[model samples]
Target: MSLDYLVAQPVLEAERFILRPVRKSDTGLISHYASDERVARMTTSIAHPLPPGAVDAFVARAMAEDRSEDVWVIDGTREGGAELKGIIGLKRMDRNQSEVGYWVAPPFWNTGLASDALQLLVGSNPLKNDTMFASVFQDNPASARVLTHCGFKYLGDAESFSVARDATVPTWTYSRKL
Candidate 1:
């Protein structure tokens, strides 16, 4: 259950969806989902026109984590050969802490798939288990709601953020005790 042999993860079956890992083959899906201005706006680090090879670079980076962190948490719709639905990940995982970040294709909105994936990750066979942090956009109530629904409690705000939209986009901190 270490998944250490896996240089990259495949689809993870959840009660309602698949939480896979990003792959080089998934660049098309990445481009498709990242193309939308709204979705792109939610996480603007994904370049507006998403410069070519960006997804590959992202996958490369995800694979470079300390083998203890599940850097890429990509979601799909079914058991196999599923259309990539979104991406959720725990960045900068320490022995007992990590940052949760994610985005869903607008088509799959309001389905609770993101929450399901998160639950699956938390319940997955991983050793670095403990409290996890979520830095959500202050303006994205939907994300805040999802975090709350998944048992993450409000922990105030932080100016530090990975994908900051602007100086006004203060990040709200949340934590779920494991």
Candidate 2:
């Protein structure tokens, strides 16, 4: 289903930042952060050494009329923070379900930015989903803590391909009922 007409992306507020829809002007900062190996390797999609035009294509997809996912940038400029702290998104699924994904720039790591962003998104529940699912690579316990700290229950273990790692990585899945 196309969310372009069904659901309007909302700007969600948080104490430290706001979760706003991605825009064309965000490409440069996003590229700068996602290009970092430390950031890219942690995500399932972002390829390490981020190729040219990769971020532009990503922004295009986020703004597409028929997009399957709703992406938001963690903007902190409202409080004189970095304009682009990172990204958080929800990939639509059937049965009023959606999968959550997020990343924080290396500089923003350990600052509770990811946790705050995830909490804001979950609290907002923009898609009005019945349930929201999330997973983090087992190697990244910090992200797992972010989910659990936000009240997500551990579901089980799984594996997902990491483009940056170029291999299947073990993941811990978690879910929360909205």
Candidate 3:
């Protein structure tokens, strides 16, 4: 899609969650979820113990880079008010091959927040029909299931460099053919 088109759009919503842009105030809440061992262990990007104020820094970057990452302030709409429950985004958005990635708070896990937001993240947007890919760590079953629920086909294993954790992580590739 064109740059102007993406910028003009507004927040996306699913049945139970709202995917709005991230604000500076969302740092604390992001850190809370991102810091979880269960949450961090699964993803190759996040560092263990989730460095202090790391989430704030990430949010700041997201706001600055409109072309690369469009973050969402995930709120549980069906359950209650706009209390920040998690964050989702179209990270690594290569117009030729964009990717969907997200994290929900531990308290909100097993409730379909990730899947719902993921659907919103890649569904019928500027690049929904195009080929989209996701690299999930082998150990994270929840993440694997999320990809499966989103209709992503298993494309086997691949290796990628993760700057956040400073390692070459093993990632299984999942793809949705548009």
Candidate 4:
């Protein structure tokens, strides 16, 4: 997509959740869910025992006009779902590609929220991306399932530093041609 087209981020809707841009009011819930060690350790960015103001800073980045990534909160209020079940985002890469990432609050695990959210985002192709990439820590089979269910083919194995784990973790890389 062209720069002009990419500038305006859109709110995505699924049957059970609404993928909307982050708002100032969401900081508390973001901090609440992300602060959990279980939630933070599974991903690359969120740190365990989340430092003060981390959510605020993340919110600011997500809301930035020139941000390279487009983030959406998995808001389920419309369907009487949890206000914040998780978050999903796409970081723009070269050649009409984007990297997808997401995490689900523990309360919503095994409830198909993650899978639904993944399908919603992949189906929308909100960034108008020609390709989408993703990676999941090898230990997180559910995440890998979500990606494969959405048609992402395994690319290779790699390692990424986890801020929460404080160690480099093995990851399985996957990609999909949109």
Clashes in each model (backbone N, CA, C under 3 Å)?
0, 0, 0, 0
Clashing pairs in 3: none
Report lDDT (Cα) of residue 17, candidate 4. Answer: 87
Residue 6, candidate 3: alpha-carbon lDDT: 43
TM-score of 2: 0.95
Give the per-residue Cα lDDT of candidate 4 at 91. 99
Tens-digit per-residue lDDT, 41-151, candidate 4: 999999998999899999989888888999999999998888889999999999999999999999999998888888889899988999999999999998999999889
The CA root-mean-square deviation of candidate 2, after full C-alpha superposition on the true structure, stands at: 2.4
Using lDDT as the measure, what is the rank order of every candidate, best first? 2, 4, 3, 1
Highest TM-score among the candidates is held by which one? 2
Point out where model 1 deviates above 4 Å.
1-3, 7-11, 65-69, 73-82, 125-127, 160-168
RMSD (Cα, Å) of model 4: 2.9
Worst 10 residues of 2 by lDDT: 1-10
Worst 10-residue stretch by lDDT in candidate 4? 1-10
Error of 2 at 103 (Å): 0.2
TM-score, every prediction:
0.81, 0.95, 0.82, 0.95
**Model 3 poorest ten-residue lDDT run:** 1-10
Q: Residue 55 CA error for candidate 1 (Å)? A: 1.5
Candidate that would win on lDDT: 2
Looking at model 1, how many pairs of residues clash?
0
Cα deviation of 168, candidate 4, in Å: 0.6
